[model samples]
Target: MTRLRWCLLAIATLLASVLAVPPASAAQDPAPILDPIPDDPAPSGLGLVLQEVARLPKSEPSAPPTDPRLVRWNRINHVGELPDGSGRLYVPDLNGKLYFLDKKTRTPSVYLDVKATFDPDFFSAAGLGQGFGFVAFHPDFKRNGKFYTAHVEAGNALTTKTPDLTPQPKTGFHGVIDEWTATDPKAGTFSGTHREILRIGFSGRIHNVQQIDFNPNARRGDADYGKLYLAVGDGGNGNVGDNGGDPQNLAVPQGKILRIDPSGTNSANGKYGIPADNPFAGQAGKVGEIYAYGMRDPHRFSWDTGGSHRMFLAHIGEHEIESIHQIDAGSNLGWSEREGAFTFRKDDRCHLYPLPADDAKYGYDYPVAAYDHDPPANWDCASDTGHAISGGYVYRGKLPALRGKYLFTDIVDGRLFYTNEREMKQDPTGQKRAQIYQLAAYDTAGNPVTMKQLAGDNRVDLRYGSDAKGELYLLAKANGKIWKIVGTKQYAGCKPGPKRVSHVAAAKNWAPVTPSKWRFPGREVILAEEGVQRPGPRRPFEYAVLKSGPVFASARIDAEVRLDTPVEISNRDVIIVFGYRDDTHFYYAHLSSDNTIYPHNGIFVVNGADRLRIDQQWNANRSHGAPPAITDEKWHGVRVTHCAGTGEIAVYVDGGARPVMTALDTTFGSGRVGFGSFDNIGRLRDLTVRGTPAE
Candidate 1:
């Protein structure tokens, strides 16, 4: 057969396989199928909505007020939630002011003024990416009131001259990550502590320290808990061309991702502690702080807390391809040597570095996803793919269709793309894997608006943010707007069925009817009494078991819970009991509390009234982030799946595809399932559990 005929046959076969599934039943499946390549990838207009949150503060009179820089009108860079759990949004402008907006009231206020505290002259570069870079609240910020900020500082004190061309000490400034504390976190202001955590010096000011963040879910015992990850650029001195050597150099902090304990003192200067597990720690002749190296400018990166804790970073490419990478601890992201899976050379006009025959020996970490620039003949205008790439989160929000999709966008063109995280890793070439989709954002009029159009300009400078609930937002620096992403509820051909085998609700019709359904007795046991069920107050061993009839070896259990009061970590737990063989033998999971062994949370098996954590690999010091906040009053979706055949147990929250906790153990075969808590008052509803019938 001819090549064309063979291709046609292949397409027909794929179509048959996909179209064979009935649309009515497809929605019942646990996973959703995405259009690998939509026929009209850039169909007509838009599909998303952008709502402006707040505008930046007006420029001061002392500066050139008329200049656009003074207005900082459209330069909103980053957005995050405060640790106080107030649910307010915090935004940083490149001009040096930290603005906080209470989304509920739609009011914006200055939370902290970095320019006023630091010498603005040091960060007074004309570039758009300069000045105050980013801020991250410590994981324990709620309790410790500690936070860190990355900004440009005036002094070259931390910089060492490069020996040859007009020593950098005289020509460069510094990028500093300063730790600050708030005596009263609710006061909306920071205490003037200002402890210097780390600093990167630059000959020119484009790629300074870009971001500082801690794993929000990290608990005390997790490896990543209290560890701050900082990304630095190659100290690009645009004034004199690239004064480059930092990305590949280990001694300097620039062009690398550094992980340090913000609260511990183990450094030579005793400011911060070097994580013992860092990739370069204890290595000879290398900086112990380096987590990964050889990066030009890793502008933005986020941890996939809802999934595998893998980090995805969006690195700006040099001339041709913009790239995205999933980094490993000691991974070497080739920068000066390569760019976005392509060879990169500063001096080469048609810059292309030939891949070495023995590339594996180089220990280079190539981008998992990338898009080439337009104007193939000569690099000219922005191609269909935008110029700069912006990193985003793995969508684990309430949007069922978007679950597990890694969302990213172009800073210049403002085109947002969502790719299957698993697929991206499986097919790194990204050719057959799946080309990035231009997420269509629409307005109330049903008119499709380009991301650039939403920002009212081509220079969107798009950035992404995720609230505590994992809902994502897009920040348009050029338009000075924040867009909350709202996905279509009923996904095409993937809407969940109405009569769920696992339907749960907090209403009367769904209440437990028999003694066997809710068979535990305790003082706080109000199982579905007043429109809700309290298995027991948060206390030790207070459990309400569903001792009714059904039992299974493999099962899927889902429950909706609401915390009536605050959660005290030391004495609070939302436990889901499963695989119960008897009263003294069963498996239960602490869904949202930290314990010493599995700091974040884990599953424990009770044998003869003796409880032992079965999933130690996912326990404390092994996991990242604190447990999910189970007592926040908002209805939280909890799911537990166990397959005895594979001895695999997985847990999910908020309908996220990614399992927050997982383990494989065959200690117990099958039994009953139930729900309860430790020392906290919470309401539970929709306790629906389904599995194959027991023999």
Candidate 2:
């Protein structure tokens, strides 16, 4: 017993034989038999369903040597986008599965498993939990495939060696939100139908509620189109109870954000309803499923792809502030009596109040972005540097080259910033300047932050995404990588030879090109092109593959490249190609010889039988930090490839994954690539070169 509890008792005996099977019903009364042909009114035409294809040939250029078996499964924690566009990712381990992934071939599968739905005492009365928020769906989720989830449940009569001293099972709460249905939203597997809508209960063990979402302004046939919104948090250690922020209390719902409406008709008091436009429905006795209220650990929240009904929260503070608010409907925010724009436990004695004075004009809302902990401006929050601020989004789609920038971070110094509400209200003494980067940040706040010279390390957790045109995506919560936000055309005077990598063939018209020549003292630089097309929220193109010694290496092809920071050459021979804009972290695509630097952590790929060392780490503070080798205005990526006799290396990214590092000994023979903005500012696209043979 041990090996992680024998892999958790063989994944709880393979999820109890895949939940013992049962589903599949489309209603009885089957049968068709018949022949009735009438009225061929000779005036009808409307048919087109084509399906038949076979065209394969042009994809040559394959010097083999690039497969090293690859294996990485840190297991997902959160991932989305499935309004039909596909892609669902969620794996709160402890055998709590949900999977799905396949936005084409990201390959995943599982579907659902919490011990086959529930009741082995649900895991010995509350003791095997996992699965925290984000599933929702239901905009008619492709014609009623429904969908909902908010997990965290266990059982064993409730533990403590039980004996019914009021032992668990008051419906076994520890946070539950269920809903399910999916008999087939284009099929993958999870023969749906389950029910249990709301349950909330947790005396400790951190925040709990986690996420829910679904209300991008909602509408299409209304009725709150599946209204949800949740968020919770403030149940763990950080004092507040006494009925927390009292929304008039209802025996505690913990610091609130709810919303409900799961289809309506309130089933005898809970299973969803409360939505007469919410805001205390009929007042008098409140709790109509709260919409907003003072929060103390709200984690993450978003909605603002431009349509602007605006929404964005990310509270979480205990010592000094760390905020980002603006969300209404019943608004209250100002937990423990304000902690962001200032004033917290101010002289204790309780009794504090003051919101609604244009608190962002009416319904309470302040913090388009915040940061504080006393300092010469951020001396690593002085001490206790863990968890505070991790909510991001705002760069509405089609990268008009990063239109409107907003992004956000700080799950323990994975600091990556970007501002724009007019530099966040003219920089409130916090100085205005953002375009900062150190391998695109990630470290899900479990306490981990250290970096002064940036070496390499990660626990990844930058979770949050959106695509299918609404743009936004940043999920390197520790390496599930997926970044999308692009823009280019900023080269200074380009002229770092290798034929400028053949002018990167103009990146296929998504247009916005640049590169005529800039400060290039070269090590290798290229930017050639051929039908590029990668950037997305929808697709665009440019070209970049730069580097500039003194310590500023680089790489840029947009769509992916985030490595937080740390690079050591020592003996040369590096490569790049990255992905994992979230799931912890990993982002790069760097190479060298003439120019190709994108080093947030010199993209790793070692394992010549067994050497394992995949670099990238940068923190602002935590158990002594270092390894982000700064170089003024930072930007990095470098690449190296040599075929035959076995050698393949890679690190390409704008978001994550392309990592492939193997070795036999080729130490980059014959140089000359292109692009090097070592002076700062960068951009690039598709530049290609394969197998290298003709001299």
Candidate 3:
């Protein structure tokens, strides 16, 4: 056949495979890829609605505010019931006061003024989680009229007063826990006397004592009943080079969960009793009160009342991981030594390594549910990588839709997530992770929104709460507002079903940046030579836009790409472009064989400024962000989806169910789409795009 006639027959075969779903038996499946955050994060089925239950009164900061965010209008840190049978809920504002609100009326009043109840020095504003740290009432609060609280103190308290635990580090601040007796059990306000039960010095103002709570699952007659668990962080000591051993050292209480009896007086200081059942209670060189060790910040912990009554703690990670782990006696969650299940070395803060072969012998429990910080997509201050896991409860409430799922949040981003109670268990073989899914949030009017949008701040500073009945509440420091999970709504997540309508077959379909370096041979786009070098971060040197098709507001593009460069060459790549307003403004997926380079093997976008990486899997400090874009010279299937309305972008390789590269941006919508290489030669064929045309 003639060359022209042969090309026409090949083009007919290419169009059929580009946009259609082939039969399952078409070929063998590719190797399975490991992804912690799935490509499809949009929630399906039932979602939750948030209703404004209370607008908390603002408490003045103890110190002069140098920054508004440092001293928010109200710094509400926690919410829970006191078990006092008052049908009331209590929340503590880090600024100073503890407020109580009638659940029915949703009106709040001062329960106890920590600055007034103790001293002004007791209310530390040095950090957000410092003052009025946490509160826990006695299981029999209606009779004993007793409760517990934790707070931080600076200045004179660090010099004049001594920590309850003697022979400790001389530090900058003190974490104090006090036991208070109410004058009347049924009183509306606290008119009581408090005595110091425990105190420890901390290395810095941040990551001090975060929480103190009792096991609600333990009955009154149970041995575990009334034992208070204190979550003390590493006092910012672990982040410092040599002091990384502090959290793993059992001798100190700095990075441990300590179980103590509030009424007994057998501790070293004769204030609280150290439970003999504690794993290290009788160990020679270990602190008798340490229940579990090796945690950076055991920010918040809770017990699921229904299933095995398992206790879980949400640990805020330093560099990348934010995780949730199931806690048991003597459990050690490796911190500076391990972040999540991966090996961590203080010298290399940017990467995670596989655990050593003898990892099982160390008896370190890993996270059942975890997520790493998705690198700052826009490289701007407007967004934050996930920060601080706000631990929450496994719902046992009347809402059937929410029950059995353990709900939680990223405190900074206010992103809500959940995992099944049964699936949230550690794998003895360390080969599996619990499936975590996003739980969509909606406004009271049933309009979908994010916690960050509702709070109107980049840093939501979100926290979770549960009343005695197990219903959940979401509190944000940004707005000083409390929202309750009132009912269920169907999550209105991205259901993009773009209609396939366009394909490329001839030279007229593409507009190349450097026409001299490219040639259209038959049905393929061939970059015969490398394009000109450019001075920018992630922008490519040469590329082409599919200018002949309909204008698209959002699109899903598919193509078969092959690197024309030799397989032995490193950094060989082909970039696929979309949303192209001009040469400098568009999004591109840098498909390359190299997995170890910040600027290669992921997604990039240029909007008037130099190109910036906005992919979900691009690590800023390290190179091992995403998998290799392509590892060989052979042709492979590629897919790119962009939704302009929601600013969601995803890239799938080899027809994988999950995207290896994803991003969110709406910079240049309603543009064109095409493919080319940054500096290397490549070939593109079987091109197809399905999208909604812009009006």
Candidate 4:
């Protein structure tokens, strides 16, 4: 077998063994292990949770002479919050118009008409991906009335004389970013002064300048407060062989995340000022306008306010992987060379190339999260592969269950998937597949709606939007409809008991329930595993249970433990078992060695007689962090927190604020807190538990 096949096979074997339930008692029948992968996506048709709050009003053309496709493709692209706190959302369409939807009145009205003067025939031949790309209300829009937009306009459509607006030889298209000032902030419509900030002369209609967003929440004096970040795709004519050189070449503006001072004039061209802190602003031989290069078509990107102002980029891939990159200034995400942590060559577009064993050496930054087009048939993911990636926001809504999860989607399939941002950050190398779960959305009538259903079996072209309150919204481009995401909880399959509080901070509070030597000082509790042979099936999950009398519906547990033995003694781990509904139903974090040879480390869930690996780390998109040298005879701290209402479990190691591993499941309600490993030798100390009791 090829090396890739061998690696896949080993991963499959390790996952299969991890899910095997060892015999607890000889009298129990042989329990079956669940399939680690599903052939197709399975839907939970609970209810139609998407309600149609608004739709774009019909447009009257100045002239009735244009192609008919514009009616379908010229649909709504995004919904962004206005700076004014009137609870209004600006929905930008592909036809160069912006519609404002009022949250209170549940109505829509024209906010700005970009095509009011441009001829209708000029828009008829516009590229499929052309039109008004996106809009950004200035951070000080309420005060300055200044905002920017990125759009595709005919050459000479605007009276801008910038170098970027130079006419393209083939398409005569110019991608433009214009700054507009609203005469009145509270006016129902916009009649503003337009200034061409920057423009790019493009070879084709697609892959034009797309987004113009300022950090909405950046404080007045913050470093990133007034800077506008622009994302431009590589203007490559793919019909010919001109595929994406701009992303890798840094001297130009295309295929890059650019940072500029829209209101300042410190640039070489003086149209806009390049941010002094940009990654390449002062670097010799690099364009000062470039922030970070190497992207094919960054179809959409968003600044995470809930995070530390980190920008997440979603790039449309070439023939294979669609990627979501966590961008840091000066980062060089390899495109035309690397796609989603793997090698990509324009000459060998049809063949798959292995990722370099050491990718960082090449100075190429990979996505914290990425998915391939070809995944094994059995892996239980949204899909083993997908077409284009639609960028989304980090859920900061009131739902305690959805917070901290980044929700992104696939355009071809319209399948919504999410991964914990904390988990992706831990696997920065992109070696670990980011765990992805398909979101089962429903219509307002409680009818289950699949992406295909919403797309009318056509290209879904799924796009995401956020309201003034940060609640997420979904836009169906094919249908020209807006959807508000609503649900009481996520994956509500398990029952949550009454709220109860429990805490066990003293060392003597934990009671040993298995073969063990327990020692307790005032500050710590140590349990040394005895060389006792487990008398049952070879189930790795059948750990020796050490319980604390704290029943929990949701809680956090912190403990410090040291591995006394070397990692060579088989699949040994320092496990933190929680949500213990019974001896059979519980969850555990298997903190194992950084054993490169065996990829058996991750979180697992036990439901009745069956055990499954629910954590994102074990499958095709495993986000499990690389194992650390835990067997070095050192004390490593472990913290685990679970919210029953959200069915979210986060595992933190070494007192890090972010979780190294995360999983979501509402299988069991309340259970005792326990600590143990699967037939492993370890030392546990400083055990403490704090949480709501499961009644």
The TM-score leader among the candidates is: 3
Candidate 1, poorest ten consecutive residues by summed lDDT: 489-498
lDDT-superior candidate, 1 or 4:
4
Better-scoring candidate (TM-score), 1 or 3: 3
**TM-score versus the correct structure, for each prediction:** 0.60, 0.26, 0.70, 0.62
Q: Against the correct fold, how does model 3 do in TM-score?
A: 0.70
Off by over 4 Å in 4: 1-48, 58-74, 120-126, 155-162, 165-172, 237-244, 375-386, 426-429, 454-457, 490-695
How many clashes (backbone N, Cα, C below 3 Å) per candidate?
29, 121, 0, 13
Model 1 gets an lDDT of: 0.64
lDDT of each: 0.64, 0.43, 0.80, 0.66
lDDT of 4 by residue, 395-502 (tens): 788876667878888876787777677766624465664566556666665444566786565677678898867888888776777788776333333333343323
Estimate the TM-score for candidate 4.
0.62
By TM-score rank, best first, the candidates go: 3, 4, 1, 2
Per-residue lDDT of candidate 3, residues 154-225 (tens digit)? 778877888865323558888999999998978778997899999988877778899999999999889999
lDDT of 2 by residue, 529-548 (tens): 22233332211123233221
Q: For every candidate structure, what is the RMSD over all alpha carbons to the true structure, in angstroms?
A: 22.0, 27.9, 15.0, 14.0
Of 2 and 4, which scores higher on TM-score? 4
Arrange candidates by lDDT, descending: 3, 4, 1, 2
